[model samples]
Target chain A: MSITGIEIRHLRYFVAVVEQRTFRAAALRLHVSQPPLTRQIQQLEDALGVKLLERSARGAEPTAAGKVFYQEARNLLTLAEQAAERTRLAGDGRLGRLDIGVFGSAVLGPIPRIVQRFRQTHPQVELVLHSLDRIGQIKALRERRLTVGFNRFFTEEPDLSWEVIQTERMVVVLPEAHPLAKRAVLSLAEISSEPLILYPRTPRPGFIDQMMRLFHQRHLTAHVSQEVDDLVTAMGLVASGFGLSLLTDSGRKLHVPGTIQVPLRKADAATVDLCVIWRRGDDSPLLAEFLQEARALRHPPPEDAEPVEKPAPRSAKRKRAPKRR
Target chain B: MSITGIEIRHLRYFVAVVEQRTFRAAALRLHVSQPPLTRQIQQLEDALGVKLLERSARGAEPTAAGKVFYQEARNLLTLAEQAAERTRLAGDGRLGRLDIGVFGSAVLGPIPRIVQRFRQTHPQVELVLHSLDRIGQIKALRERRLTVGFNRFFTEEPDLSWEVIQTERMVVVLPEAHPLAKRAVLSLAEISSEPLILYPRTPRPGFIDQMMRLFHQRHLTAHVSQEVDDLVTAMGLVASGFGLSLLTDSGRKLHVPGTIQVPLRKADAATVDLCVIWRRGDDSPLLAEFLQEARALRHPPPEDAEPVEKPAPRSAKRKRAPKRR
Candidate 1:
């Protein structure tokens, strides 16, 4: 009755005996000596308190019990083999699941395209998307709930790896009736005098830091206005003439009525990067596949281009912002 | 994609890694060095052509592929254990099937009772019943189609062993109007002078041989007026006053109208043994149980008897046919 006493070897031996229909034949098939095979069978019988085989001068045959055992043994062996195969596939990253952390704005950009491409290749993988802020994503990654995260800024963390995808030029959202709304471009000097609205005030030193750095470079102080926790609130305030707010072009996917997106003057323009972050050395195949797709979509290979062993990493330095007019 | 190289050890290692969430911890659990566990994982990955684990300073985690592998490996291991357990039970003869050979007339006596007792003790066993004559039963036993057979005549065979359960006393089946029908008992000397009928004329040297031997010993001869293929047909002829015939008491279970069974005189009575035959050394627990029940029924033990370490083997020799006047 104690299954602990039963071993894999017993199943193999029993199955061999049933298939060969004789102890001698089963022993030969299993590449073992007949006496040991016979002894093992006896041990099995003793353990189960039943007689599984009948040995006559003519040959050996399974008792009714033996036949049942033989079938179960075969099933177990097959399952074991299947487990090995499935494990290998999992290791290869061809099969499994991925839990990904996504910030709101990320869905409007490379994240969706990257996810789509990854799915096309790895349909078997289960992809779970959780909406979280940059800080929340980082915490979830450390806790192993989220395999990877896509956000608008990157911070240095030794325990985490960061890969920047694209740097988007900043634009201004203004009420359509505002005097500057008709202007094709507006310099930092002009906007510096205007009351400004900013969003996602918490998870600090993030988007605000980028804006502050831009004004600090020109020795101009940004006019303090109102700070909100979400882009929609910021846009709402702007449409009500609560001053203008800066957002990336990808945010254009969401249209707030009565608000107009305007390109900044070249000298005043600044850009923020969208990046991916994950726990450093996390080796889930799903994450790897997502990284590959994100990188490929952000920086596609040129047609008919010769292969390069390693592509040069993108520069972190911001490029000169192009003028709108 | 070639899983042939992936061994059970790899599955164990991979599962341990995922459970421990680190190769170092998995190695500790498996009692192997971390490097080998890591290498085996890599080998597993190579065989499956997938990445299964992400190893970092914090620990290791299954990639999506690794996750799938982990579940399958666990299943395989569980099945292997179950197989062993089932095999042990089969060896114990607690779980299996038995195909029994039966003759039409044998079912009227101890065979059905023996089968019922065996079933009550071994409910897990599957019992298959096949109706066969003595010759067919013997051939089926040799071909392994039957586990054991209940038959009337015992034939000598080195590959088969036989045990007599009961010897049925012979009785005369006579027509209601026959002179012997009114007698309490009749002698072979009296019956020898009257017309008689024998059944199943084929398979020479059968029950007729046994009947003839009894008559020859008495210095008498049977006047067989007709030969029929079956007992029913023989009974029909006897009902019409064609002749009288000898039958075992169990045949009385068949209610043949217009016939009467008359016990023979003590000096003239004959008996035939009903025996069980099986391939010698067949070690099915079902057969063992059946034999025990049958023997117990045939020879009920005295009340308050202590259990014997080994019940004496049944004597193979036929007993003297006791007088039954």
Candidate 2:
């Protein structure tokens, strides 16, 4: 027999008959004429191949088979209603999943703030953060792999809307024994003259490009000393007296031994903006809550209002300045 | 939102679109035109408040929200179909429960054999045996609490059909030390003069009535010495030299240490029938299997063909004779 032969209509009819205890009453309760109701019940019995009710002069009663069928039909209807309700919630973005495209360093900054605040407010929403490169995040967002993304690099994707959430000034990380280590704040030109190390040389047009653009805008070439693959490797190189590197305050918290992180004088010019990006026309309900939390974090209320605790990475090991060499 | 608004038809339409990957092809496959298909999907989206498909020059593709909805809808449909299939099986008596009403002593006779054989063939059937009295069995059968019953008592109930399976000769049970215990066979008149003991005095119209009817037919009065509730208690009474009793061979198997069972000479005239009863026109599929096994047991295969070992209750302790009292 075909499984789909029994549908919601059949279940409703069976439950009605059992509850009403008679076909005549069931028909009246269901607002249908007796002939059609009887025909429907007959069809349901035929579909199930079991005599659900034994008709008598007084009323009808469920047979052993009918009792079992009634219970299952009730269960099936309940599950169907629950499925519909949950699916509706999922579609409305009140329930279901949110895939956030994240960059490696983004996890240390606004990503944590946005995720923490979103989880607190919308605890029912499933949050999945996919660590990807800026290009990967952009492709995934377009391919519908991500609901939203947190990244620094911005490109002209007319189909997407990017809103900058936080901007941080750049800093110079130098080996303690370096000549410029004593400076509280150093100019970009003075640091550019020294042998400078940059990270993640591969995956072109990424953070490396952002660093290179800063030098190119000034019409000065950087003294390339070493090209390392990641922030940890760059920090290791600086600690071993290789060269100086440029990064943000979040990077300074790494605290590499024998290294001193000094703020750059041209902070306003050499800065990076962490932005939240999504498809231009995509008005996902959950994204609105995320954007709201992110905006609140970017601009906290006054001191008289509830305190906004600064989001810190649990792995932070910040040292203002190591013993001067 | 009203959950009932999202019916199975809506899920079918959504799945069709997702599978065909284009509204035009989906509508064609679904035997519906494109406009209606588009409208149906829009309505579904409106109900869910989420954009399931992203329209493009190539075709329609599922958004992140659409993908999740498609998966959930597919699952719900599959579950509903399975529920229907199982319910149908239950209605057809191919699956589901079978409650067999049994009497206490019935377990010692063809009941165990019938149950074991039925279970072997109908492994998928759930068998539950409820031990009740003769009246309890009849009442339960009428109320649909029992699918079938194993009983010997027959009443003039036009609504029930009773099929006698086995009839066995009655025998005499006596204290080992009694003078009549020496006889290989005894007549009703020989034991009628002795103090007779009856069992299961409670639950009217039971085995006691059968024994009483035998003596009444013989036009002889039994000299009852003691009345007991169960077979074990009766056996204990006989072992204490209280009186003699009438029982079948199956009952003889419950041999007490100080008692001896002897075949009565008028066994042919003093017999009882064991029958299986069910409501007339009550066709439960599992009952057919039970009847088949029971019939096979009644007329077992020849000794050389396959030895049908006689079923005996394990709790038996027999003594041929004891010191004459």
Fnat for every candidate: 0.51, 0.26
Encode model 1's per-residue lDDT on B4-118: one tens digit a residue. 5666577778888899888888899989998888778877766666556776799987755566777787877676556556555454444577889988666677788888877
Tell me how candidate 1 scores on lDDT: 0.75
Docking class of 1: acceptable
Q: For residue A120, give model 1's deviation from the true position in Å.
A: 4.6
Worst 10 residues of 1 chain A by lDDT: A307-316
Interface RMSD (one decimal) of model 2: 17.8
Candidate 2 scores a chain A TM-score of: 0.68
Query: Which candidate comes out best when scored by TM-score?
Result: 2
* Candidate 1, A108-174: lDDT as tens digits: 6768888887888878677889999888998999999988888888778888888777777788889
